[model samples]
Target: MSRALGIYIHVPFCKQKCVYCDFYSLPRREDQMDAYAAALRSQLFETDFSGCEADTVYFGGGTPSYLGPRRLAALLEAVFAACPIAPGAEITLEANPDSAGDPDALSALRRAGFNRVSLGMQSADDGELKSIGRVHTMAQVRSAVEAARKAGFDNLSLDLIYGLPGQDLPRWRKNLSA
Candidate 1:
């Protein structure tokens, strides 16, 4: 039996760097987006993906949605042209609720073949989100989830983190229970 292959695409663009985050991400440069997309396409074309089929394609980083629709579509086109993603494959994109919660953004993602979205919910408590330099509120996360659902995405994932300031055991338990 042949093993399934997965594509991991890193989008190193963030609105602002988080103190807790140590990932490789930089600020978004609108002027460089096209060049970066071209570079990615060139690299994908150069890769030797002959027999192995891609069962999953994940776009992770500071925030994938920061690229907006057009650039992301171009990248997706390159992925489709260079590698064969199996039918019904999981195409995931990591996004922050602040930017990706809107209906238009979610719809654009769905149209571009993103079947799943990993939203960085961080915590259910708004204070925790604020303390972590996250601009979006928990309400925004809920709204984003609803928007994603409305956008026809059935496979939705939320990223939650523990050990924030002022978080007691009971508070954590309450957070989990909510």
Candidate 2:
């Protein structure tokens, strides 16, 4: 029997760099996105998946949602065409609070064969979020969660970061409780 594999596609584009992060991420330049998409497509096309099937497809890092809806759809389309994904494959996209907040964008993702969404919550407290240079508010996270639900996403996931300059154990507990 052949073993099934999982796929992780890294999208190295960010709206802005986080102060603590040193990951290699290119700023989203309008002129460069199309080329990025093309390179991604070319790479996907050139890869051989003859004996293995993909059981899960994860679009991760700098921020997959930074590509927005249509571009993201195109990426998904390419992946689906190039790889043999299982019938019930877990397709996940990592998105920041501000980017995944749009209902239409979520809808587009759903249509593009994504079944899961991992949101970058950062922190529940607005102050904690700001201390890390996150532009979105907790309110935006709430809205994004709501929007994800409305867009028919049941397997929603949230990611949080802890241990900041002013983050105490008590505050961490409070953040989790909220």
Candidate 3:
């Protein structure tokens, strides 16, 4: 019998680089999006997944949401074509609030087989977010959550950062509560 595998797709592009990020990623390279998508799809289609079934597919990286719905959908389509996905598979996309807080885009992603979203909330406090070079604000986070819910995403997660350079206990607590 074949084994069920958890697939992780890495997107190495971002709108801008974060000060504290050490990940190997390209920032401010929107021009390469189409080329990157095409290359990724070619790679996915050429991979050998002979006896494996994808039970979970996670799209993570510099900010998967930066790719937008159409590009993401195309990549996901390639994944579907190349692999045998199990029924009710968990397909997750790691998104940034700024780029993903749109009802229409979220709906498109949902229709493209993304069942879960991990939003990079970082911090609810705008100051902390700026300190870390995150472009999204608390308001955007809220909007993203609402949009995700409206798009029929039941499985949603948030990514938070604590203990920044000037972050105090009170501020951290506020982040936890907000």
- Winner on TM-score between 2 and 3 is 3
> lDDT tens string, model 3, 121-142?
9999998899899998999999
Query: lDDT-based ranking, best first?
Result: 3, 2, 1
**Which residue pairs show collisions in model 1?**
none
Which is superior by lDDT, 1 or 2?
A: 2
lDDT of 1 by residue, 1-58 (tens): 3457999988888788777888987874667767777899899999988887899999
Which 10-residue window in model 3 sums to the lowest lDDT? 159-168
Clashes of each: 0, 0, 0
Report the C-alpha lDDT of model 2 over 36-140, residue by residue, as the tens digit: 988998999999988788999999878889888888899889888998888899999999888888888798889889999999888898887887878789899
Instruction: Give Cα-based local distance difference scores for all models.
Output: 0.85, 0.87, 0.93
- Candidate of highest TM-score: 3
67: Cα error in model 1, Å: 0.7
Give the lowest summed-lDDT range of ten residues in model 1.
Answer: 27-36
Tell me the deviation in Å of residue 130 in model 1.
1.6
Better-scoring candidate (lDDT), 1 or 3: 3
